[model samples]
Target: MGIKSFQGPRQKQTVEEIPLRVSDYMTKKLITFYSDQTIEEVISALIKHRISGGPVVNDKYELIGMISEGDCVKHISESRYHNSPMQDMRVKDRMIANVETIDGNMNIFDAANKFLSAKRRRFPIVENGRLVGQISQMDILKATIKLKSQNW
Candidate 1:
């Protein structure tokens, strides 16, 4: 017979439930940089993570801007071939402000719609007014393709 009830004391995990939302599908362990972090550090971070860009967060964990590979390339070009003092440049001085972002609770349709309508390929998922995770065009496309193939 299937044991219907537990005779011993039940155990519970201390972890809380994160509301299943677009945020849930996002990459939780985000690789981010600070405004005061050097350009070298930023470039190294992007290369190390194999990502195109990341959000720049402050001490309060609030998203202030984003730095992409494109931004770095443009920065280098604008410097007139000057050798950047590795110790001088900071993320804030080179980051793209007014970046596009979305909430985690939004669905894939919304994410896709944003990508199509807004012309933005990546999304920083936020929760409680704080940066939580990131989702990119690749992630969305992968999800779409995977789901479509499942029934085929």
Candidate 2:
């Protein structure tokens, strides 16, 4: 007798295609700070918005740097030591001038790798030399969840 074939014809699996582009997940509406703004203002904004940091831009809305809670904390510590006032500190003085940006069209997986290698919380997306949006670790997690059914 011929060997019994237990398994039937394989059925194709269907997966809904999801766009994994960075732009799709990046935050378009952002609370940005001005270089001339006072640290006190930035601190208040951070607290009110429940955000750790934000991007700094110029009059033309060009991304110049980033100001974070760490920067504000450092300034506060230094001000206490120097007996200086916090109001005197400006965003430009404490912001990170060398900002790293990503392209909007980049794949989400590639962006995740970048976050791991850069040790960054978020990456700003720039287009035509203008600040467009920002993608964070949270965004990557969201994407992973959405793509779980697929290759993941």
Candidate 3:
């Protein structure tokens, strides 16, 4: 006796191409601060740009550390408690020296995973040890949305 094979309906599979690199979604126009800059000045720039924090670069635009609102708050608290002037505080003293950075060529998915694991809201995108741009959680979300909206 011969058995007949059953055939199911053929389904079309679509593959979506996503922008793979962090550089694709990173913001090139960055608001960076210097280590020697006063905490007050850094806070002013952050408020003016409406940013939570930024990367601290040296004279050669090399990433050294990061300064954030949390750092500024700490400075404020210390100054208030000690009755010291906030103007004397510098970014280098308040900024995190061991900064975590990402490369521009890093995959977006990898960057997203890193963001999920870390408490940081953004990551500085560096190339050749130089600060080129910055990538945030929102940037990854925006890129994903754009990729999903594309016609397959």
Candidate 4:
């Protein structure tokens, strides 16, 4: 007599496409700053919004640089040392002019890797040289939580 197999017919596995792009988890509504704005104004906004940093843009809303609370603090220290008035300082003077940006279509995993490699807490998502949104470490963590429940 021939041996019988115990396995039954296998069913097709349907896996859901995970939403893992930078755009999928980025914050679209951003509180941006203008380069001409005074550092005091930036500091006020930062305090009001409870944010550490923000992107600096021109009149066209194109990203030009980034300003952070640390930048403002540095300005304060320098101004005190130089005997200069803090009211005269502008965001453009203390902002990080050389800014790095990421693509919106990039995978979130890759973005996390980027954040790790670059030692950045957030990355600006740009498309066609225009600021679209921003992705932060918290966003990546949120994505991770969502993916974890989906058998990631």
Best by lDDT: 2
Mind sharing the TM-score for model 2? 0.88
Error of 3 at 18 (Å): 3.5
TM-score of 1: 0.76
Error of 1 at 93 (Å): 0.8
Task: Go through the candidates in order and give the clash count of each.
Answer: 2, 0, 0, 0
- Stretches of model 4 off by over 4 angstroms after superposition: 1-12
Worst 10-residue stretch by lDDT in candidate 3? 143-152
Which pairs clash (backbone N, Cα, C closer than 3 Å) in model 2? none
Tens digits of per-residue lDDT for model 2, 65-127:
999999999999999999998899899899999999999999999999999999999898888
Superposed model 1: Cα runs more than 4 Å off:
1-21, 81-87, 149-152
lDDT string for model 3 (11-130, tens) is 898775567789999999999999999999998998999999999999999999999999999999989999999999889899998989888889888999999899779999888889
Worst 10-residue lDDT window for candidate 1 reads: 15-24
Error of 1 at 9 (Å): 39
- What would the per-residue lDDT of candidate 1 be over residues 1-152, giving only the tens digit for each residue? 78687679878867554333465467888888899888878888888889888989988888888889888777767665786554577888989888888877787767888889988757887667688889888877666764663432
TM-score of each: 0.76, 0.88, 0.85, 0.89
Over 4 Å off, model 2: 1-16
- Candidate that beats the other on lDDT, 2 or 3, i.e. the better one: 2
lDDT of model 4 at residue 16? 82
